[model samples]
Target: MTGLDPELADATGKMLTQAVAEVVGDDPPVEVEESVVLGNAAEVLLERSCGAELLVVGSRGHGGFSGALLGSVGQHCVQHARCPVVVVRGSVS
Candidate 1:
């Protein structure tokens, strides 16, 4: 969970949908579901990872040391997740 305010969370969900659409285009080859949960991000993600084939997470999220190789959440998930974890690092624009 991101712990975002309700208003921001709603906007984030919409943005996530839009981003996925932009990436996959009209007919995505794979199914995708976007959601935002409220709680500790790592713990929530870990819980959901139980039956998942893969768990993808960002190298660093909204707030973190920019120079770090991985953020706390990503690091935690990488260390403890039950499934394969993919840590995607965003390019700096």
Candidate 2:
């Protein structure tokens, strides 16, 4: 998974991990790394997808814009990711 913003990455990772645990009934090992792309989620996915089996990213991001469409990073990854990508949507419940 690509996480460009540290704060967003942390929060999302925690939520994802929790959801997985709830569904699977076990806490698996999950590593949330901070990519070097900083503010660019596309660049981070491009770099991380070299040998990755799947690319997972949020549909929206930590930007000021909020609408019904996907964010810039989500759009770019959908078009450019080497492998299959999963774009998770909705806010944490």
Clash count of each predicted structure? 0, 0
lDDT (tens digit, per residue) of candidate 1 on 1-93: 345687888888889889878877879887765677888888989999998888888885455565477888888999999999988877777
Whole-model lDDT values for every prediction: 0.82, 0.67
Q: Which candidate has the highest lDDT of all?
A: 1
Once fitted onto the true fold, the runs of candidate 1 whose alpha carbons sit more than 4 angstroms away are 1-6, 61-67
Question: Mind giving the per-residue lDDT tens digits that candidate 2 earns over 7-88?
Answer: 8777777886676666446544664343334455578787687777777777654555555356777778878888888877
Clashing pairs in 2: none
Off by over 4 Å in 2: 1-26, 29-39, 61-68
**Weakest ten-residue segment in model 2 by summed lDDT:** 31-40
